[model samples]
Target: MTKVLLTGASGLLGGNILKHALANKTLDILPTRLGGDFSVPEAFRGDKEILPLDIRSQTWLWNIISQWKPEVIIHTAALSEPGACEWQRETAEAINTRAVKFIADLCEHFGIRLIFISTDLVFDGTKGDYLETDPPNPLNFYAETKCRAEEIVASSLHDYVILRTSLLLGASPQSLRSLDERLKADGEAGKTMTFFTDEYRNPIAASVLADITLKLASGNNRSVTGLFHAAGKDKVSRFELGEKLCQKYGISRQFYKGARQDEVTLSVPRPKDTSLISDALLTVMNFPMPSLDEMITALP
Candidate 1:
């Protein structure tokens, strides 16, 4: 069995990846260095080992590397939420960039395959149709760190895959509560939502993204050790995504207005377009890409 060390086990993407990895018992998954807390999902509870780690500290990292000695490392740990990352700049830089570099070095030393999860926000919402090869124009420190990590991962190990994903959905127990609070506050305050019509992204269901992530991890690319766009097949505007949510849950759409990018108060600039479509992801499963509406409406 190939031992895989999964970082950021508490995050939406990391949690979902843990779910998918569980079904395949042939793969040994060790959930480690979860940032804040350890909320083990049912899928990973009985079958896997949970290792509490602090990726930022070299001492913490060395301990795990010495013990786990994993054959492959999937880096999902990050201060991903933009506002949180922005507010906690030091923590963000440490985990997203510095810790990731540590993992990359370990991967190189241990001769293991590395899979690093990145984001679409690396582009400052200026260009829409971004490819793996496109130059990154990060708007915030969070994005800047992720981009830096991507560069380090690309160059550090000869065998690694750098995947950039979009916003994650699908009822993350942690994330859902936050979303509900934000939406409820907005609804109650009668705050008019000005979602962008011009800025676009292809937000993939978290579950789907997880499955694709495993497929890529299972087949660690040697020749394809570079950046990849891990997203849905079609692109939709933020306005469309919000509208879909309101319609799906039967919320009043009165607060929603089709606004352009310039109208939004983005603390950090967002990409005007960051829709990622890949034949690589499409090839692994028989599932059809779910539109934002279907994903929202079918919420369990």
Candidate 2:
């Protein structure tokens, strides 16, 4: 059985990945923690071995990697929230930039296949449908850190795949609510939320990302090194996504407000359209990426 180490296993994407990994008996999944408010999903309580991991601590990371010697490490733990990242720039750099470098260096020395999960926000959003070959021009602190991490993995490690994904939409564990779920909860609570109509993203299901991650990890695609844009098939605005979700789950769309990127001012500069086109992944994997409606339909 292949041994795999998964970081940020308590996050929405990481939790979903952990769920998918647990189902595969051939792989031994070790979930690790970095920091943040995260709880182990009830279903994964007895199934996974939770380890305390501080990616920033080089000595600790080295010792753990040397002892466990995992064949693959899916790096998902990072300061993900754009707003939070903007507010705490130094902290974001420590976790997202420095920690990633530490992990990549270790992975390089150990010859471990590392898959660094990145965001579509890495692009400046001057244009949409960004390809793998497209140059990254991050707009804010979060994207800057992520972009720096991607560079470290690319230039430092030989056996690495940097997956730049789009906005994710799916059901998370009961302990942690997903973005879509949060929106729904806010609406139900009679809280009006303004979604961006000008800003767009190729949102993907968490399940789809989990499946793709596993496939890449359990493979002989040594030639598949470098960056790959993994996202959904449709390009939808935030407002449209919210409207669709409301219509699907019988939530009220009246509470949903639409605004353009220029109309609103945020602490951090947001990309106008970071929509991705995963043609390389699509051609290689030949797997179908579900549409927004399909993702909503499969939601529990």
Question: Number of the top candidate by lDDT?
Answer: 2
- On the 0 to 100 scale, the lDDT of residue 176 in model 2 is 33
**Model 1 regions lying over 4 Å from their true place:** 35-38, 41-49, 175-193, 219-224, 280-294
| lDDT for model 1 | 0.74
Taking the candidates one at a time, how many backbone clashes does each contain? Answer: 4, 0
Instruction: Please give the distance, in angstroms, between residue 218's alpha carbon in candidate 2 and its true position after superposition.
Output: 0.5
Instruction: List pairs with backbone clashes in candidate 2.
Output: none
Tens-digit lDDT string for candidate 1 (1-300): 768888877667777778778888667888775555546666544556667888878878878877778878888888887778888998899889998888888888888889888998888766676777678889888899898998899878788888888866675535442333355457667777666798788777777777766766664433355567788666888777777765555568777788886776777656687776655545544446666666555454
TM-score of each: 0.87, 0.95
Query: Alpha carbon lDDT of residue 158, candidate 1?
Result: 81
TM-score of 1: 0.87
